[model samples]
Target: MKRPLLFLVACMIAQLSFAQSKDEKAVAAAVENMRKAMIDGERTALENLADSRLTYGHSSGLIEDKPTFVEHIASGGSDFVSIDLLDQTITVAGNTAIVRHVLHAATNDNGKPGKVALKILLVWLKEGGEWKLLARQAVKEPAK
Candidate 1:
């Protein structure tokens, strides 16, 4: 009986650990959509996902508003060939979500192939039942 009870408790805890909240699920989907859009350089998708007041920061210390960010990404000025987000965490508070992840990507910025590894922090806001990227900041990835 004791062994059965312990096993049941362990199963419950494991289920709880794997479960995601509703908002967390939405945020994760949005993050994946953005990743795909970035790699594809979809201007309309990028524009739709970003809030009107977006503030995007780069690891190279460049900061851009919504228009600039969208344009640069869409025009291939800052191109992403492939993006892999690792060890992501999402926290929701009221209408805002804060997400952090390690981003490793292949890029072709201005026709030159390169790779980038960054630690990314992203803020998303829910407006009219849709999640939009409000802010994002990226920094150099820490050595492992």
Candidate 2:
């Protein structure tokens, strides 16, 4: 009996350490959905994911509003062949979430294939029971 009880408690502790809060999980899911939409050039999904007043900034110092951002991605002007998000961390405070990650991507922009590595910061807001991207900024990763 003691051995089984100790094993159960240990498993419970492990599970607790891996568990995320409801909001945190939601934000993570939202981030994943956005990534998929970007790769697939899903116009509707990209539009829905972005807040009405989104401010998107690129590592090149280009800034775009919601309409421009969605249009560029959906039209395949900003095409992503694949995206990998690494070392991601999410923090939720009230209805806002701040997400940081290292993004490595294979891209084919206007028919030229390329690769990029960037550090990304995203701000999400919970609106109408859904997480929407309010802002995002990216910076090129420094040489190792």
Candidate 3:
């Protein structure tokens, strides 16, 4: 009887770990898709990936809602030349996932070229079997 119980516990642990891994992958994919959309200036894709209640906070302390965020990307206000993400970590909690990453990018905003490095925190929620960005906040990384 004790052996059977131990086997059941082990199986449960394995299943839980697998599920977490799967969720983490999905969350990571969602984040990557968003990044690609941002780089491509794909407004529709960006709109689709983000929840309607999204709150996007910029490194400069500016906050934007979903519509404003979409408009800003679509309007060519900021164009990304390249984006490199590093040290990404994703944590899944039920239907919610938190992602932390460092983003380094070359950008041309209104024709002013610059490079930026920031630490980003993204919150995603699973809805209708899809992960959508619910909120994102970024802070400028100190110069090294």
Q: What is the C-alpha lDDT profile of model 1 across 1-144, one tens digit per residue?
A: 999999999999999988998999999999999999999999999999999999999999999999999899999999999999999999999899999999999999999999999999999999998999999999999788
* Candidate 3 global TM-score: 0.86
Off by over 4 Å in 2: 1-14
Question: Sorted on lDDT, highest at the top, how do the candidates line up?
Answer: 2, 1, 3
For model 1, the stretches where C-alpha displacement exceeds 4 angstroms are 1-10
For model 2 the TM-score comes to: 0.91
- Stretches of candidate 3 off by over 4 Å are 1-20
RMSD (Å) of each candidate, 1 decimal:
1.6, 1.8, 4.1
Per-residue CA lDDT of model 3 for 9-128, tens digit only, reads 999999986664888999999999999999998999999999999999999999999999998887879788789999998999999999999999999988889999999999999999
Q: Name the top TM-score candidate.
A: 1
Q: How does residue 32 of candidate 2 score in lDDT?
A: 99
lDDT of each: 0.96, 0.97, 0.93
Model 1 lDDT at residue 61: 96
Candidate 1 Cα RMSD after full superposition onto the native fold (Å): 1.6
